[model samples]
Target: MKNKGVVFTTQAAMIAAIYVVLTVVFAPFSFGSVQVRIAEALTILPAFTPAAIPGLFVGCLIGNILGGAMLPDIIFGTLATLIGAVFTYILRNQNKFLAPLPPIVANTVIIPYVLRFAYGEAIPIPLLMLSIGIGEVISCGVLGMILYFTLNKYKHRLFAL
Candidate 1:
């Protein structure tokens, strides 16, 4: 039992670390006015374990800091990610295909306004939405489903949730 607990903790920590690293690796594409946030693809992992809650939140917090977000973006952006992660966590066990979608949608809807109003961009709402939403669709819709399928295949033995 103790060994199992240790193993779980290690895996959870590893997930958090990977999420952070991936966010950093893609930081340029993950932040700024228009971002794809390929790392958000990993948000689908919650379907495999509850630890993803903290893993994702901490990852987003760290990314926001390193990504150079101001107070409003940090607070609101992180809140959006947290909210989407919670939603993903709630339905994680029910449908893995749907897990990553909420974060994509949430970020797409919120980040555009953040870019426009918060960052002082003169970007029109619809155009901003188109650009940002396309990025998200590529990230979450394409890559998310890929990760979901890959994880789903090994969910029983590898995931341990």
Candidate 2:
């Protein structure tokens, strides 16, 4: 039992660290209204492990702060990731292909507002939505799906906790 908890904590911490690295390393494409945060691909991990819920949230929070996001972006953007991770965990039993949908939708719906109101972007809200949505689709849908498929093949070995 103690080992299980340790494994879960370790997994979550590792995931969070990986997310921060990906976000910081890809800073150019990880921020701004027209951005594709490659770290979002990790959002799909919730479908395999519940620890990812908080992992992604904390990761996004730190990533946002380190990325020089405004206050609202840090708050709301982290919430968006948390919500998506929870939903993904809830839907874990469904089709593997659906694992990325929650993050895609959550970020698509929440980030544009963060951009317009938080960052005071001059771009119209609808256009921001379009751009953010496109970025989410690429990060969560395309890249996440690729990750999902690859990890699915080694779930037992990689996520055995």
In the order shown, what is each candidate's alpha-carbon RMSD? 2.1, 1.1
Give the runs in model 1 whose Cα sits over 4 Å from its true position: 2-9
- State the lDDT at 89 in candidate 2: 97
TM-score of 2: 0.97
Model 2, global lDDT: 0.92
Best by lDDT: 2
| TM-score for all models, in order of appearance | 0.87, 0.97
Clashing pairs in 2: none
Report residue 39 deviation for candidate 2 (angstroms).
0.1
Highest TM-score, which number? 2
Q: What would the per-residue lDDT of candidate 2 be over residues 28-52, giving only the tens digit for each residue?
A: 9999988999999999999989888
Cα error of candidate 1 at position 60, Å: 0.9
Show model 2 residue runs off by greater than 4 Å.
Answer: none
